[model samples]
Target: MGELIAVYLTVHTPRYCTYETAFAGKLAHPDFRAVRDGLVEQGRQLAGVQPDAIVINSCHLVATFPTVVDGTPRHRGILTAQEAPELIHGVEYDFPGDYELASAIIDRGRAAGHVCTLAADVHYPLDYGTVMPLVCYLDRTQRIPVVPVSVTLANDLEECFTWGQYVVRAVRERRRRAAFVASGSVSHKLVRGPERWPSPEDQELDHRFARMLADGEYEKLWAWLPEYAETVEAEMGGRHLAMMLGAILESGRRFAAALHAYGPSSGSGNYVISLS
Candidate 1:
């Protein structure tokens, strides 16, 4: 049977060396450096697990109402992120796409009355949110196949969780060893400073949420997500977090979650964490 070996939560930024050499400079912020190191460690642990495929859901790839799944067998592109063209432009990405796994997720979601769709076009683009993590967490040597999913902003938190449930069912059915990566930020209340933390109110909520995650308080975390998302301006309405939460917690598995590192990005809160 297939198994999910680990769940990793990370923040993607165009300023990272792997993503943008031009803008890459010393990570002066202690917490930001720690986050970088933590991500490297997570990638190392993931490599050791030798997962059959990596399933990622990116906040930048938000869909209207359906969860978009990449069904293309091969993904090759030169990404110039419209959002941050100066930092992340003309970055080449060529990797194997998990067609079989993507198909399974789509089938299972539809069967379960969830909204999911497939993208098979070879020319489909990769967003910075998806590309940044791939380059940072993986290298040319790994060559691991990936299945990318998109955020559905129109859906409620419960629906996102249901989408995750379908993913679990599909993974088990296909007997694929998989790793899940949720790439986004917390307390995404943009301000002037790139290194500035969110406002005091949002910072408090973000820390509370982080505490709950690290403590493995899934029940309380789920109960608090709606309020947290609404109050804190969580990135992409906290859709990415909800889906990741569903994938791990809905599996009925207990994880000893570790907060590897956390930092601030343009007034938002970010972290590199592993649920293992």
Candidate 2:
């Protein structure tokens, strides 16, 4: 059967799509440089796995009511991020979609009584949350098949975790080597400055939170999630993190690969973390 190769947690801020285009070359921070270095390192680690396919759950790909899994045979889109069109515009992307894997995930989830659906619509658009990770992680010379997962508003944290359990079953049934990525931030209280970091309180808490995950302190992480999400204003209600945690839980709570980087992007806490 298929085996999960790795789990990655990273940020996909639009401004990082390009080197000089962001902030009109004005915004700069030591954290910015640190994160850039971290991404390069993260990319190197991902490349080593040679994953047959990638399953990504992006915070931006919010589903209507059911969990959405892309089943299209081909994925091609131009993304001009709605949040910041000027800085992240006209970015073209083309990648193959894993119809089989997507189907298996849906079937397994449906059988388990979860609201999971396939998104096979032609040319389904992908948000920056998904694309930016590809840009940062995937090597374009060889276009690996992508199975994009969505965080649905309908499911609470527990349901999302169950959905992830089904995802693991589906991946194993499909018999393909895969990678799962959680693409979003921790402390996401957006303010006016791109280079600005979150408050000292948020910064301290975000570090602790990420450390909890890396340390495989699931009990403590869960215990602190609600307050932490509210206090730091986690992106998308921390659904991406919940799903990632679920996926990891299904993977037997394996130690996090290594948390190599943590930084701030427009007041949000981002990290380049690996868990396998």
- Which lDDT tens digits does candidate 2 get at residues 157-268? 7787777777777788899888888888888999887888889999999889978887888766876787888889899888887877777778664664678788878888
Q: What is the lDDT of residue 48 in candidate 2?
A: 80
Q: What is candidate 1's local distance difference test score? A: 0.79
What TM-score does candidate 2 reach?
Answer: 0.92
Residue-wise C-alpha lDDT for candidate 1, range 109-143, written one tens digit per residue: 88877777899989988788888777766443438
Candidate 2: regions farther than 4 A off: 19-30
